[model samples]
Target chain A: MLDDVVFWVLAVVAVAAGVAVFRVDSMARATYALAVSFVAVGLVLLLFDLQFLGVITVLMMVMEMAIMAIYMIMFMGMNPALMPMSMVHAKRPSLAVAVVTFVVLASGAVLIPWPSRRGAPASDLTVSLGQALMGSKMLVMMTVSAVLFATIIGALVLAVPRGRYDRLGDDLRGRVDADQPDGAGQ
Target chain B: MTLQTVLLVAAALFSVGLYGAISQQVVVMVMMGLELMLNAVVLAAGGFWWFLSPAPDGQVLLLVVITAMTVEMAMGFAVATLLHRTRNEDMTDMATDLAQ
Candidate 1:
């Protein structure tokens, strides 16, 4: 009974914070609201006995939100993210879509005849998870690592306005330029 | 406690995210919506694993989804940074042309 109560409470928190993400005026508030939502969801995962995933979710989401807050502030131009502003557009249609989606999904959840469990859970879930990663799912782990590396490289490439060659001369042996204005290289 | 109950929560979270993603004008706000949706998926995946399968494969799937969420957010921030730096615009309506 206590577990059920906790689950319900976390569910409310997760959903409410998600709603607040769009309702809040400032970018920082919206970002943190989403973070709260994710943390709540992580706690729910913990309730499900997914200790590692739950903990990782909490850590990753909090860190991601911090970085995202910085990016939102840095890129919003003239510090408008700090000021109150309308965060949404085409509000009516979006509301309609959201409502319809929720109704459909909720109905499906309630109406569907789910399958029964065929076997008991592993005694050591985390150990089994580690073994799976190192065993049958090894390829997936390798691919995900490659993808993460590529994402890091890709994001850096897209974000940096000045290339190495632009900093150093085309021949790659110029004095380190200093005190250049933004967009001066172009 | 039950799978249906967990799924109901996921559906609610996902719908809110859909609303935000469709309505939000700012790039980062849209990305927040996307993250929220992924957050819902994580919850549902955990619930499914606990109540139905109870296998390590489900955990692996959850890990992959979370990783994808991280990658997506990183790329989103990068694109937002690029857009702001190059065009001085952050609203989606202002960035109508990709060829520009």
Candidate 2:
């Protein structure tokens, strides 16, 4: 009973917020609404007994939205959250396409007959997951980790304005300030 | 709802998100669209686990997708910062220099 209640509530909230994400006038409001939606869905996943995935989903979206907020502040620097701006560019055509696509895909989803379980669930579901992941999917996991690492390094390189050379002289500390030209800092 | 219903909802969400991603002008909106798409994928995984597999592996895959979303957001933000510094605009209309 509780699961059903949670599922319906979350499902409603997710759909509503997902739509509001595009409908909102302000960028910040949309970002937070989207985050809330994702977090709600994550909680629903937890209700399904997928504790690890649920927890990660909530954490991941919170952090991602926070970073997006920071970017909005730094780049737009005009509180795109408070101000109303039309984020949409090509409206009528995009709207038509979006509607058609949603109809076709949703139809496929309703029409398809999902498969049933072939066997009983593993005795220790978590342990089985870990074994399966490590036994066969270790390479994919490693690749993702490496990709994240590279992204961090690349982002650092791009976002930071000055390096060690700007703070300190080549030899040592000398109240140094490199007067770099525009478009040459990075 | 049943697994089929859950999947149908997920697919709808995914398609909506994809449409937004392809058509949205603002980069941040595009990113939000991407997040929505990822959310749909996660829902499908969870539904599969609940109805078809009932195992933790499907759940783990969903967790990995969450992690990937975080990474994508972080990288996107950093690039946005760089672009802002180079050009005083955030709209995709002004970003046509790359195409030119």
Highest lDDT against the true fold, candidate = 1
lDDT of 2 by residue, B13-63 (tens): 776687678777877778888889989888888887887878656756775
Error of 1 at A184 (Å): 14
- Model 2, residue A133: distance off in Å is 3.7
lDDT of 1 by residue, B1-100 (tens): 8999999999999999999889988888889888988898998888888888998899999999999999999999899889988999888888979857
lDDT at A159, model 1: 92
**Where is the poorest 10-residue window by lDDT in model 2 chain A?**
A177-186
lDDT digits (tens) for residues A1-120 of candidate 2:
777777888888888888888888888888888888898889878876777678878887887788777776766668876888776777777777778877887777678776767566
What's the distance in Å from true for residue A182, model 1? Answer: 9.9
Once fitted onto the true fold, the runs of candidate 1 whose alpha carbons sit more than 4 angstroms away are A77-82, A166-186
Q: What interface RMSD does candidate 1 have?
A: 0.9
- Model 1's CAPRI class is high
lDDT of 2 at A3: 77
Clashing pairs in 1: none
- lDDT (0-100) at residue A123 of candidate 2? 64
DockQ of each: 0.87, 0.64
